[model samples]
Target: MPAPDLDLRLVRCFTTVAEHLHLGRAALALHTTQPALSRQISRLERQVGARLLDRSPRGTALTEAGRVFLPRALALLDSAAEAVAGARAVGRDRITVGYGVNLIVTPAVAELRRRHPGADVRARHVEWDRVRSSLLERRVDAVVARLPLDDDGLRVVVLREEPRALLVPTGHRLADRRSVTLDDVADEPMPRVPDERWNAFWRVDPRPGGGPAPDGPLVESAEDKAELVASGQAVAIVPGGEHLRRVRPGLVAVPLEGVEPSRVALATRAGERGPLVAEFRELAATHLVG
Candidate 1:
């Protein structure tokens, strides 16, 4: 028999209920009553041929089947949203550029806008770890990323290079230093970022002594790393730029020595020969100064 078509509405309802784990709260969040929400869940369960949630007077809990289906359901929702956005962008002279933290791309964006008055240029903030994936997944047409990025299938233009610095708590020993070397921080715990290449580059993994830096708390965002540093739980290496001058109150960035300077680059897919992408890449090369 052919598979049944799944309703996105039902999937959304189930995910919300899974998140809250309570019918009452889920109903409120979905803006529907408990009984109606229960009906929706029942309809979904009937279509899927499995019970997704176990309901009790006290609360609700996911059945084994629900746990397996949740992630796929979320992906479906994400793809649906991306599909809608892509459709809307069709026939429009639009381009979205992604940029990482502490990196600036505004000057290039403004120049692109000035040159192509009819072009719809937009900037999206890309998390440090998502730089490559954002372009590969078509989330952004191009990105301004800090390098040591794995550029296997991408065209990369080196914009500039800048020294890196270590972010430490104000009272830490290294915080008082004019500068420090890899050996100085060899034993210090560094924030654990998701991407291996990124983690290796930022943490200066496999130190001069030849092993990975001591692992600290796992960090997913700049804010997370900053908080961990402020609390003295971990230290992070970042671009030594003007943005560091306004770092969080409890943290300071000390110059890091004995390492290669970080490079800022504009990257797009290898297959992208679009004029807008080409133009923006040229503008970034010209206007993005370190």
Candidate 2:
């Protein structure tokens, strides 16, 4: 005949009794009275349809069935504990926030932490190209990115509409002209937006040459771009916030007269956000915008 279906509770009782080899001690180990243990053992025997213990003058000895079943019983309990623990670990949530150079130290990010205390916020300084990909794959919950995205799958919350500024060397011809127009430095070599963005539309490339064809200086991080301009190495165009002026004293930020400005917006995957992701978007809107 095939073996009977196993009962987890019975397995626990059998393992406890076999470990102690005595009813009273096994009862204490299991935190139960001796009579309850005896009844449990009786129930298990009826279920398994076998004698599991040999009662004698000395104490209890395991029957052949009990000796074979002990290891299997213990194994079942171990598996259950592991499964429960694994499930509990998945319950702790972690959300990823995507941004580039300047947003890392911005007040928006700072307020995000302040509003949501101890929220698991993982900030990744990803390029524009990877930001949407990360959002699509659920690698990140939301992204604070530049506006006019080519992709239409995600939704956005406009944070600010800031003016575009000219990044020029301090001693350059128009660097100290109060504020230079796009026509003023129309002939200088342009620097390209360093971060590799998914869509070219969101990129703020170098306008030093004043024309297409990115043959000029390639700048990556915003702070580094400012340093290059300050040193008179290469000039670039930047947004107002991206030019965190404290560190770059030599660079002059002049508002460009003609070129259209860029809008900074928060991007997130479409549909309803979970509690954690929703909270981040709310806090960003409250503190990031004017």
Candidate 3:
């Protein structure tokens, strides 16, 4: 028998639903209605000939089949995205660079544009957590990333380092201090994020005495983290840069003492040494003064 012809759209819907595990949330993420998302998931389940998710009023859980299929589904989506990017890059002078929050790349981009008058150079704002993956998946040709990232297969050039600071609510005990050490906020709740390395580094986890930082609300974005701090729900350690000084109202950034500074760097896929990318990397190294 011939295999079932799967629709990539349905696969994408399944992956989005699987990611959030809530129809309404997944729909919001995908910019579709809940009923539409539900129908898409049902169509995918029928095509796959197995129920991938077990949904109830309380919550949603992945079925045995889902656990088995999730990785393959992710790989499929990644491959599709990469293929599209590759197709677009051929015979075109285009390069898209992604950057994390509060990091600037315009000087480098301007230089590159001046050097290659016909090249299409674009700058995109990427979320902190997605910086590394954005490059590996070919979502962007390069990225301006904060350091301590998993640079397994990328060429990273450290631009500079910035002192780290602790962000606390204005009325918090440490807010008025000239500078605070890890011990000052050791017992305070910190926002937890999905990236373990990122979470640990920013939280300064596993303190000198070897205990984990107190976990608070889960955050997925810089705004989320800043909001949590402003609301007095959690504290966060962020780069002590002028641009990042006043991220949210009711929050104050006090210089954090006794910790490694944050490194900012330009990163690109190791194998992509094309002229446009190379020139941009060199310009970034020289121009992006942290």
Native RMSD of candidate 1 (Å): 4.2
Model 2, stretches more than 4 Å misplaced?
1-92, 104-118, 148-152, 193-215, 219-224, 227-233, 242-247
lDDT of 2 at 127: 70
Give the clashing residue pairs of candidate 3, or none: none
Whose TM-score is greatest here? 1
lDDT of 3 by residue, 1-290 (tens): 88877888999888888899998898999999998888888899999999998988997788999989889889988898888977888557899989888788888899888988888889999887777788877788889988778888888889898999999888998888989999888789998888789878888887778999888888898888888888889889999874245556688889988999988988899888677888787788789964
Candidate 2 vs candidate 3, lDDT winner: 3
Clashing pairs in 1: none
For all candidates in order, the CA lDDT equals 0.87, 0.70, 0.85
Error of model 1, residue 284, in angstroms? 0.4
Residue 29 miss distance in model 1 (angstroms): 12
Model 1 agreement with the true structure over 165-187: per-residue lDDT tens digits: 88999999988899988878777
Q: Show where candidate 3 strays beyond 4 Å.
A: 1-82, 242-244
lDDT of 2 by residue, 1-290 (tens): 88787777877988988989999899899899988988888888888888899866699999999888788788889878766653553445656678855664256556666667776656777675566776765666778877666456888888888777777767778766667775665456565564444113323333445344334466655566566667777777677556634336667777766667778888888873577677778777876775
Q: Give me the runs in candidate 1 sitting further than 4 Å from their true place.
A: 1-47, 51-71, 87-91, 242-244
